[model samples]
Target: MSREPNHRLAALMAEAGASNKGLAKRIREGAARHGAHVGTTHVSVQRWLDGGGIQSQTASFVAEALSAKLRRRITPADIGFASAPPPPAALGASYAASLPDSLNLLDELAQHSLDDGQPSEILLPDGEVDSAVLSWLVSRPDGLPVDAPASRRVGMRDVAAIRTAGQMFMRLDFLYGGGHGHKALRHYFRQEVLPLLNGSYSAKVGNALFGAAAEISQLLGWTAYDTGNHALANRYLLSTLRLTKVVDSRMMGARILSNMSHQANYLGQVSRATRLARASAEGGRGHATPRAMSLFAAHEARALSSAQDYRGAARAMNEAEKFLEQADTAQDPDWLSYMDEAELVGEFCHCFRDLKRGPESVRFAERAVALTDPQYARTLGFCRMVLAQSQLLNGELEAAVTTAGLAVEGGDALQSARFQRYVADFQREVSVHAENSAVQHLNEQIRAAMAQLDDE
Candidate 1:
């Protein structure tokens, strides 16, 4: 409401060198991909310049179009459109007692969460996590009903499409961060996947369909955690955990528990984190492959380290390393593509970092950096930052400064709030080196990078 003349939007247009007609056409084209019809013209653009209002969705379109041209992420607020909505207070909280119960809930939750673009500072209550986990622990896996629905004919092709989209969204989250494609992922799930769940299918086809839906739901939880909506993340993960029984996927349930442990640690629930991680390992032992089990053990190592259980942490890491060595990637599920040496080592490095074993942490961090895919900017930046911290602990000031600078560079390219948090936390830790000119210069770089992020 403050920018009555909409000068900010005009300036972005000029900066992107987009004419009124060109920008209007761009918005329409982007909308069309999402099956939205837009009739905007240069005339509408002119009205926006003269202080006329734009729709929230159109505002989002404008911000996205300009971000593409400028090659940086920006919100509607950056161009004086109304700020994106706050995250939902709660989502997908119910632990469905049956497959049919979960289907309707998942459908409703995916649609509800499509509008949750920003994280709320206030976290949701985490007590329900224990309740959901207990429910899942006792729930029996059920086969799809023998009698198929006659609503619409759902087939393997429809399941394939949902599976493909789930993979794509997972990759996008890995590359850019959860804040990047979360809403669009939810939008895709709601639009493309939910309808098929209601369609008619044979028991075999229905099993596959539920599996595909569980994958997307699991990803929705993962992204929600990355975006700092802890409570929302808990609900999504819980819902996905309930869905696992439908598909009879103990491995998937184990993965959900691992994620819950990860979030619990981040939220400072040390004991809960350790419990959840241990549960993942216990429940997934026979059901999960070496790669999946390795990841679960690594998570337990992390939670143990957080609680200052040195011997316990080391034992868990040993198991993880052993399992990692035995991993066979060729037979991995599509969702388990991230369960590799790089991810395993990254977790190991963080665990050591938590245990204050600086040299050991640095060793694992270097391996993580060396093995990490360059496209995974968020994880790479986080590992680099941890390496820098390890260097600082070892009294290697110059190496720490250089590594921290590299982390800052990697972080600036990402759209992840979580990665930004890492950079910020490292910045505070490096304050002890304030007297060194190199450290001060790195500090300046971080400040400028933060400004770039904050300005948007």
Candidate 2:
């Protein structure tokens, strides 16, 4: 069967005199303004022009780029993608009130993501975050029990296996980066986990299964975020949040929202990031462990730092530290174990670096470096880059070059696009000192390291 040609898109491209390559270039450049890096190629543009659909996030980027060039309000619909639904706002659905709807929505989302393949770009819209948080807060816990068909039965052993697999994948992501194990997680969910959801189980077992699924989903979401698939990450996080509500797991839900906040902050949506972080804290009001609170506060601090509100950032950081002091590992959830003082100090390093407090940034970065595990390649590299950046800004050229070398050494071993972006930013910052021999040599080393990683 042949599909219809996108006459509207072809006509618009003709009117704008936009060659496929030209359009792709514009879209890629435009996407950066929204804090997204799109690998838009001429082939992508050709597909769009041939009546093939693009991801909603990419479609929005396309419309915006074309609208700017053509001086018209071009939309997804205008370009023959009106029929394609937008990326899901799944987190906003009230799990208790709409159990069946939420489950069906998640099922649809999983199928849609598989069908669309990996997204080439993502647009982090503020409205989506606000709506998700608001809906989560107002919703009640699910009262209705799951009624799986009286057929094949699921047991505690099955749930335990899922949880164990999730932990294994989480460890892989921590050591090797999210791109290392995200596909395996997606496959496990689709092949192994989905069947259990459809299998028969008592209400007690069903709750346990859903809770385990939520944790796995959250990891899937985190891995996607680490790999730079922000839109996919958001969808998975939303599903996790909804599942958390279904299981009445407030602490876990707060953790999910905190992850969402981290992504929002990365995308430069500072205001939305702050809102989500605060909302997460609020959601975890009674149940959040001290470690969890520390994590939330640190995220809030990052958002404040991004907005250049140094005092607010400082207060949030203090709160995080206070909470960390009170944290008891045994009382905290397993997920909260990683949110230790080292991580908090890394957040401080990030905050100070963003605020251009060179000495403070270096101090915290050094502390974080000492405390961070060697197995956490991506985190260590990020902290080193921040330290190098602080050294550069503090006018310690030799130390900056040396620290940058260390960063690149670790970077070469990781497969994280976020790490690459931060390194790129560091590269651009150091390029200003191109007159120095040490700076030039360090630049070459970094480029070579990145090239080796790419080739591998």
Candidate 3:
């Protein structure tokens, strides 16, 4: 699997007039600024110069350092590593405060995504969420009605098209799973949305365009998260939040943060998740639609439950219920329409699961499964698996096996990383009961279904 040396990196270093030791020192220092303590040495620099693969984060730091030295942006792609876009400017930093900068950043991200860029596999630390939240909290909002001029005269039709595409993608994600529409969504952003942003428009139209772009980025981030790509998800989310600031759309901003909270929660960063959830609520504040408020509170409840704060989780869930009572679909954004009673019950099911309250978990899970839309086959199966787990938790072995068999029936209908994890978990739990004929039969059925899917 050996490959050619990355001559581009060596050339860049030479252009920057940095020696091996010098480049390593600068990269180490740059990583320190980003809170990544890399002990890069001259030998590491030599290895990179000789075309050896480096850690993605390390390569990012090297590009960042070179950018500073060369007075221009450098990216992993520029250095002949994997074709990743430049890591975004430090989240919430001054580099992210301007509208033109935000647009440029998102455009770059869109291009990378469309190129099928492979991000580093580094799992973001828990503290990374906290840092991003802090930056957002203190960040100044982008000024309204962009003053910059452009070449082409853009109109509302373009904006409407983007919004319409967003709706389509969202529905696809809901029905099929994040994996189904991800590439198509990225293509839309790159081919359709990027040019719209580059074109000229009146301030009113410009603002609308930015809002549409923000929503697209939010959905992109959500899909990336759903597909188990946390680093990529964070990049999209940061862009979404930044774009929201440019548009000053509090509801959209809140929803984006809530999505981030869910990602953090699933990563087992409960403390970070709780903070992100609260930040989501604060983002919406006085401007929040009832649906927005309910979703934010539900996110917070999930985080609290994960953190083992039962009382706080209960309070948050009650607050969510109160907000749900006030929800008016007419007043809410199209994006929030999916957060209906079934979804709310599903969220409650997760909270109870985290709290290990088996009977309650099973109750909510059953209700969620019953109420879920039939088109959302993957979600229905996932909820059923959750019910099976809860049944097992309550010592109903036979019932658990039966429910799990039902879930396994349509497990391959959609491509979902989360569903795979759920399946693995169910398999492990039932292994203890392998001697039981029911459990054995269910396992055989699941294995057959999965193997069939693989063959197809």
RMSD (Å) per prediction: 9.0, 5.9, 11.3
Query: What's the ranking of the predictions by TM-score, best on top?
Result: 2, 1, 3
Could you arrange the candidates by lDDT from highest to lowest? Answer: 1, 2, 3
lDDT of 1 by residue, 1-456 (tens): 564688888898899998877776677556645544334556667777766666567677878888988899978888877753444444466777777788777776776442233233233355666777777777778777644656689888988988999888988888878867888988888888877777778888888898898899888888877765565677778788888887678888999999989988876788889988988998798899888999999999999999999999999999999988888643678788777889888998898889999899999999999999887878888889889888877788899889989988865343565665566567677777689899789978876665454335
Off by over 4 Å in 1: 1-90, 113-127, 411-413, 453-456
lDDT of 1 at 63: 83
Candidate 1 Cα lDDT to native: 0.78
Residue 102 of model 1: what lDDT? 83
Candidate 2 local lDDT, 292-386, one digit each (tens): 88898898899999999999999999999998998875397555667887889999999999999999999999999999988777888889989
Best by TM-score: 2
lDDT by candidate, in order shown:
0.78, 0.77, 0.76
Q: Could you give candidate 3's per-residue lDDT for residues 1-456 as a string of tens digits?
A: 786888999899989998887777677557545644443556667777776666577778988989999999999789887753454444222225576787776667665441132332234455665665566666766655554576677789988888899999988887767767887898889788877777777788988888888888888877876665566777788777877776578788788889878887876777778888999988777888888899999999999999999999999999999899888643876777788888899999989988999999999999999999877777788888889999999999998888988887875433565675676678777888789999888867866775454334
Clashing pairs in 3: none
Quote the positional error of residue 195 for candidate 1 in Å.
Answer: 1.7
